[model samples]
Target: MLPPDFTLLQVVPELETGGAEQTTIDVARAVIDAGGKALVATRGGRMTARLEADGGRLAQMPVQSKNPLVMLGNAARLVDLIRNEGVSLVHARSRAPAFSALWAAQTTKTPFVATYHGVYKAGSGLKRWYNAVMTRGDLVIANSDYTRDHVLAEHHLDPDKVVAIPRGIDLDRFNPSWITPDRLSELRDSWGIAPDDPRTRFLLAGRLTRLKGHMTIIEAAARLKAQARNDFQILFVGDDQGRTGYGEELAKAVSDAGLADRISIVGHCDDMPAAYLLADIAILPTTVPESFGRAAVEPQAMGRPVIASNHGGTTETVAEGVTGWLVPPENAEAWAKAMERAIDIGAAKRTEMGLTGMNRTRQLYRVDAMCAATLAAYERVLDARRLTGKRP
Candidate 1:
């Protein structure tokens, strides 16, 4: 549904590996498949080569800078690019880059779009004003209904201008059948779990941060141990992201609770599909609400039951008693109880739940579906511009 020779320019702070960066690449690939040009302007990162491989050209810009003068300069540079490259629309995925994109789009009389990817904490007036740039687009894309509602409540905007598009999972990459037993065994061996170990493995996959509830999961592990439930292992699979002090604190907590053997903080995993296959259950015990809980969905796509906190986007993605269970946020006892329930459900029932989750994710949260819907949104924006005589 792309226009002839259309060029869509997407701006983000960096091309790092995250949901936004991945989505940008996915959209870029989609644009190329649809016979359109895709341009990405960002401070280069690990995924820059991948973006280029997908037929998206990278424009180096200091869009990540928050300095007002730098942002103004970025705006001028973007305006020049919009004019010279014939960029059809400017789509921004982060607040800092969005400010410059907004100015450039307005100056060039081009359609501007923004995606709300996080529930940014706007604790002060100045911060709130800065965050408000996301809502100033010709059309605003919210990654989840929770994010959409948050945007509407926190900012004054026309309801029609906002659309909720949940982040999607790549099923082909997450399929259980594609994950060989040898891969699972290798990961299990690396994680210190015996291949034939009968203990239920609970995996928490995300950045090892306080907000991600690593401590909460550790506390829950302690409670499970106190309840004489020893036939289980809690694996924290993620990078600490330079939070050495916090990581040390969690290690100390595990030691203090006598869970050093039962709980292990396994640093960053690059092969998540194998990791999910190795786990009996996955958990997203986030203390803070997620704008869109990809941690919850990706495991489910791999036929693993997810135990997510009962808040934010998880509430929308997890079907309680069906695909997964939702426990109260930051409540260790509740999480412990849910873990017990998941273990008690036995292998067959957990398989049933996992199948249900896989089915639900396929129907609602496939990457192809998300990309198609986004392309449709872009088409709508272009159509509106044409009808209103804003574009010839």
Candidate 2:
């Protein structure tokens, strides 16, 4: 729980999408539930209503703007907001907003925190400096152990200051038992899955990007087809995020491989819990390491075994042969073998793996646990500030 006077403000680009945005909303609810004030400064998005409904105050601002002058103006405005609202701590989720928030926090002498939400590419010194703002916090939160190691290697911050807090999933929402038959039927109908279809369903959920390894799945499907292993359906369920070229390219790959019937690029899905239920196994073949693979944990929460890339956060989330399988990243042959192994295991074995994953997920990655840990981090920073009369 937080002190009554603790007014935590989280600055993010927007609440439109992605894990960071969802975490902002989840932490905001946690703050309110703990009897503390929660404030979010952003450009506002579809999720703003959800934030406000949970008693989190919204200070609409142009924090998402990366223009130099706009960021300076945002810093001044944030300084005013902090002074006028008696903000206790500033937590920033992204770089552009962190620059502005860092200035305001320094101006107000408030404790500042930042989360390294992604493994950003820093090819240039300028980009490295820009990314360094995330490390400039009094305490930096890395979303996974992999991310934590990356942060330390790249930034060389004090070992004690950077905390590895894995991303948490909403177990209740993702739970299989909570998914009614009607929900399953609806999604099956919408996605054109027949009630008596005997094909094993595989889900590869992520944005349509080269980094997500969609083409790997397509290639694997083609390999499966070559062996006449045609008893599986692979669904690519995710938004393109306006990357139409990649989407078209994926479609062409499927067609060129003659696996069009086996592969379907179903766009963004709002009902993921049900989607996971519809599939026997979930796949996260991200070409790069996910800072924290939420996609892996979520399907596990739904009691569906996963086959993720053998790198990144999946190394921590997926329990290899226990909960799921982790093949070499972007290796189409490895992915094909993994998918074949999953198929050969049969539904009973897959269910057993899924059950193991579900139990592990419940123990390690629930929203409440994440919220509590985050709030405790906030408390530690605050207590340090009060005791030392300086930022932690």
Candidate 3:
């Protein structure tokens, strides 16, 4: 055998610029780079442009619909797409699309894979069963060791079938040298912050959702009013993504805390590397466990002290005291304490820790490393199927 030529099909709700969306782009790019065909089948969105720009074909369909009738319709459509495109593998990034993709993959006799992006905390029995399909992937890609273990515990799947492949950031894109003070200053100009000011910027980047811990960060910042108020400014980045009501809640929390000025809701940052450079500290104060904390790693690679709540993959992302501090999840007081310590420990220790973080990022979380590992898993599954003379 020759290196098997695979027409990879990625099914997701929409091509939005979330972590899973970004990962889908990565996989498609890798497929083309590795001499395979990459075809993404999804309801097109903002990210669709970039997906096609990178030499991947986009097959648009109403994949976002979740109703049973809509899903079965989509499955029939996907089966047609797969058969016509000669897709050798089907990958679903969300549970909604997974229901359709699973049926399509089964019908087409293609390998099925799932990238478990978030921890689906089952609110009810039906929901739990619905989320359980994440465990049914021929190869389940978890973003972190924390997430891999969580999937094992919650879904009760074979550990061998679940693989930990953290979200990857291009080091060159996130490198400290790549973003300059001039660029950082330019972003500050837009944000109305003085370039010469010695004040620190504590940045939080994510959708303005309740689970993301914006209120918790604001509350913590308010509690720290007596300390680091002048030097530290909290900046929230990320568009509401239809969570305007939640944004209102955050605004109310900020107002109640009297941190209206100090806590800037800088929605949807465009230049994240520059945004990281503009910050003295980076934090992901999510209440629930993030399957993998993509927000934490970029700042670390940029040599910024990152403080994330001790939930989800944050424990794995931040090397505790080495990269930054990890406070108890949702504990505003504890977050306040950690923020104080991270700031008060002075710039020298911070620089040392930041360098350590950069080293860890360089060693472990390179995009190429992630791509290689992921491709290996795909090949393993394919080879097993080939030996058995069965379609995966």
Candidate 4:
């Protein structure tokens, strides 16, 4: 809960597809429902309509640009927005926009907040400095406990300033009972999966990128095929995001393995609930640590078991051998063995695991819970600011 007159401004790169974008929209809706005005500053995209539909205002700008000059210009623009809109606080969800948001918040004496959405890499000093802007917030929100720890260790910030609030999954959208037979059939038909085909279905849904470990999944599929385990269909459901070369490489790998029919690389699907409904198991074999794996929880919410890389946020979300198996990251053999176990475990056991996962996901990762915690965090920072005799 927040003040009825509170006006919160969230700055992000764009209203595009991803966990962060969805969270931004979710938080905006929460703010509006709580009797507060919500404004989002971004380079608008497809999700803008959804945000506006929720009664969230949009402040379009080139906040996605990484150019230093552009960031300074954005700060000036944000300063004007904050002052004119009577914004009570500024929250940033991405690094590039954060620098500008930080500058604007400081210049306007507005309480600032940020969400550590990813475990970013800093190979050099300059990069690390750039990443530190997220830590400059009055209060920093980490999407998972693992992420909170990583932020403290990486930035050496005061521990009290950082808090872990795991990303919430929309259970209503992912619920099995909410998905109709026709929705599943539509996705299956679009993906060219036959109605009567009896192969176990596996799905790996996310953007197609190198670190997402598309190669590792391909290798494991090949390993399964080598052992004459051909009664499985592994669907890679994600957009390449303009990585044409990697897409070609994955196609070639699938062709060379003689498993083209077994592995399908279908681009992004809007109906993820139907996509997960069509799968017996969901996979997330990211080579790197995920700050918090939203993908891992979505499948479980659909009453389906998951098999994700055993590291990062998944370690917290998935109960190994209970909800799903957590194989070693990037190890094709381990993944192959895990897949084999999942197949051999029988339908009853898999369904039992899925039910366990579904219960856990519902208890821990609801959208309303996340929003309540986030708004409470905002209240805390604003209270502190008021106590310090600062302008609100």
The most accurate candidate by lDDT is: 4
TM-score of each: 0.94, 0.96, 0.95, 0.97
Candidate 2 lDDT over 68-123, as tens digits, reads: 99999999999999999899999999999999999999999999999999998899
Whole-model lDDT values for every prediction = 0.89, 0.92, 0.85, 0.92
At residue 90, give the lDDT of candidate 4.
98
* Backbone collisions counted per model: 0, 0, 1, 0
lDDT of 1 by residue, 22-137 (tens): 89998998888999999998988878998888778999999999999999999999999999899998999999999999999999989989999999989999999989999876
Cα lDDT over the full model 1: 0.89
Off by over 4 Å in 4: 390-392
- Candidate 3 stretches greater than 4 Å from native: 1-4, 226-228, 390-392
Better of 1 and 2 by lDDT: 2
C-alpha lDDT of residue 143 in model 4: 99
lDDT of 4 by residue, 1-392 (tens): 58779999999999868899999999999999999999999999889999999999999999999999999999999999999999999999999999999999999999999999999999999999999999887889999999999999999988898999999988788889998989988898999999999888889999878888888988998899889987888999988777788888888988998988999999989999999989999999999999999999999999899999999999999999999999999899999999988888888898999999999999999988999999999999999898875422
Worst 10 residues of 3 by lDDT: 1-10
> Global lDDT for candidate 2?
0.92
lDDT of 4: 0.92
Rank ordering of all candidates by TM-score, starting from the highest: 4, 2, 3, 1
Q: Candidate 3, after superposition: displacement of residue 75 in Å?
A: 0.8
**Evaluated with TM-score, which candidate comes out highest?**
4
- By TM-score, is 2 or 4 better? 4
